[model samples]
Target: MFKSILVAVDGSEIGHRALEEALAVARVMDASVHAIHVVQTGTYPTLILSELEPPDIAQQALLDALDREANEFLADAEREAAAAGIRMTVYKRWGHPGAEITALAQELGADLTVVGSHGRGRLDRFFLGSVSSYVVDHATSTVMVVRG
Candidate 1:
């Protein structure tokens, strides 16, 4: 019954699995699939660079690299969706992955949001913060967390 399915992919193995799972669900429900890749702009590298004098060039370069990676991830998802004969839309955002994904889902009024978990240990999750966990807690729509 999901008409719009939003999937968050990070180019990891689990992200790929999440995409596949979302596509399968979309296929079954005849839903439109939307994929989002968020380039974390607040990472340690970027933050460290920002404190330097004349950080413009370095920051831009780092952002460019992240953009390229995001594109690659979205491209793969697009190809998969094409091969699956599913209507898919893709988005790239610069922010926290979980926040961006949930915002996009709300903006698109997605009925279901799919995300992948790295299956990190409790300590790791506590320190690093889990994107899937955040999405599940914040998204207003249905959430599907595919664990790796």
Candidate 2:
């Protein structure tokens, strides 16, 4: 039985389902669920919002999208955890999703990791090459991929 479970949420319906599954498993095992969303760093803030330099239209748009994604991912995860009646810990990290997920699982001492195959935002399985796949390959703990 898993004592600590790490669930990756990305504001996608698929991610919600994965969290639901993780919560159920956590409840049965009395495990603590750690929910996380990773923001791929260096992909945002292309146009500096500074007084010296005006924001570039295209870069500003990308930044806006990335910012929204960060917010939405955390908000959705928080709602899901609340509805599940589980006071789970949530993390919003900025970096490669796969690496962050694996690190969090290890850091939290999780026995299991759960994530969706696809998520919201610009990232798709084919385009992003699958974060779940990376997590499965890199994690020491048991990983379950819920197809979105």
Candidate 3:
């Protein structure tokens, strides 16, 4: 019986599907849902060119934009959970998505963690890396991967 469900949402359609799946499971189990949106800080590369603006300013701008997007999608998830009469908590973290999600799942002692997969081929996953795969491999709790 799942009492605490953790879901990772990134504003992607697949992410939304993952949320939906989590919500459904939470509803069935009468569990609390915890949603996390991780802004992948490692994805951005430092620009060494002198023509570019200061690194601090550029980094801040990028963080700000990512924060806005995270808030938007999290808000939507909250509303959807509310409509379903489920208790949902939202969290935002800055780091590698896979690490953050697994850490939060442990911190919250989540019974299950749900994530979405793009279902990309081997080559695509090799190049792009897969958050869902990472979670499945790293999370201490049970993991559910919903393919897009």
Candidate 4:
């Protein structure tokens, strides 16, 4: 019996599937959805300028690109929620995604959290640890993981 559902998105096809599944479930339950994208300040900054004496312009451009991507992630989720006829909320956090998504679900008092089985990995179950696994292990709320 979820009243508020929080779903994490990372712009991956799997992430989109998670969003769609969350929307469908929420629609059936008449639950409000909270869609979030966490921008973990990981190697992204370093990738901007891997060379010795990094270019400032490159660093700035990378930051700008990250910002644009974050916005697009949130906006797309919002649109999906609307199209599904579900009430929705959006959030962006910059830090450890696992911690942030877990914290936000608790902070928002969500009854459940939904996330993708793997983010950006076509063979995720074999490749790497995914955001879904982290959420399932860390979140206090009930989690529904959707596989793509």
Candidate 5:
């Protein structure tokens, strides 16, 4: 009986699946879907985007690129939701993914927040940290973790 659904997307396959699940639920419950993609502007970005060059690179440039990418990802998610006859609102924020997502959900008064887990092992998560785990533990709303 969710009236408002919040789905977190990171342009990953698991994230896509989570959005699909959110859409299905929204369709059944006649709920509004809100999607968010965080630009990840802290230390976590180093671990998350290891492929990128060192931190010595231009910080502003990197953030701009990340914001553009986040917008593209959100646009794609919006298109998919629109195709299903669902009007989804998407947002882009710059911060720790978990914190931003949780804050947005609270701000929107979301009834449910859906996130995708990368399914990294405990050891890896312990070292690199897990955004999904953080969101699951910190979010006030009901949470659904779509694992991959």
Candidate 6:
């Protein structure tokens, strides 16, 4: 039984579904919920926007945008959790989603971590990698991958 549940939210439909599932499980177990959003900054600092010819994309500005987006996602997650009658502590950080989620879950003593499967094809996963897959393989706590 999970006493504390952690959910990774990306603001995607699948991610929202996973959050809902986490809330349901938390309700059943009377567990606390921790909702987190990680803004993946990848190699943006060194990479250029090929689409933009000049590629003058200010790395700092781009990072700021990502942070803003993450904050919005976390805010929405908090609202959803509130509507579900579940009190959830929301966190937003900039880093690798998988690693950050796992580390935070462990730090919070979460017994279970919930994530959504992006349904990426093998080829796509090979090139882009999968955060859910990484979290599932690396997390120390029990991980539930919600697929739709």
Best by TM-score: 1
- Each model's TM-score, in the order given? 0.87, 0.80, 0.86, 0.85, 0.84, 0.84
lDDT of 5 by residue, 3-72 (tens): 9999998888888999999999999999999999987666544434444655445655776687788888
| lDDT tens digits, residue span 1-148, model 3 | 9999999887777888999999999989999999998877665675232455655887667767878988998999999999989879999997778889999999999999998885223443564547777888999989999886
What RMSD does model 4 have? Answer: 3.6
| Alpha-carbon deviation at 112 in model 1, angstroms | 0.4
Deviating ranges (above 4 Å) for candidate 2: 42-65, 121-123
TM-score attained by model 2: 0.80
Candidate 6 Cα RMSD (Å): 4.9
Error of 2 at 92 (Å): 0.7
True-vs-predicted CA distance for residue 31, candidate 3, Å = 0.4
Pairs of residues clashing in candidate 4: none
Cand. 1 Cα-lDDT: 0.84
In candidate 1, how many Å is residue 113 off?
0.2
Local distance difference test, each candidate:
0.84, 0.82, 0.84, 0.82, 0.85, 0.83
Q: Write down the TM-score for model 5.
A: 0.84
lDDT of 6 by residue, 75-119 (tens): 999998899899999988776778899999989999999998872
Residue-level lDDT of model 4, residues 1-148, one tens digit each, is 8889999998998789889888888888888899989876663655445557655876667777877999999999998788777768899987777788999999999998988877663544564546677888988879988876
Candidate 2: deviation at residue 3, Å?
A: 1.2
Residue 86 in candidate 4 has what lDDT? 74
| Predicted structure 1: clash tally | 0
* Candidate 6: stretches off by over 4 Å: 43-57, 119-129
Q: Candidate 1: list runs displaced more than 4 Å.
A: 47-55, 119-129
Candidate scoring better on TM-score of 1 and 3: 1
Worst 10 residues of 4 by lDDT: 42-51
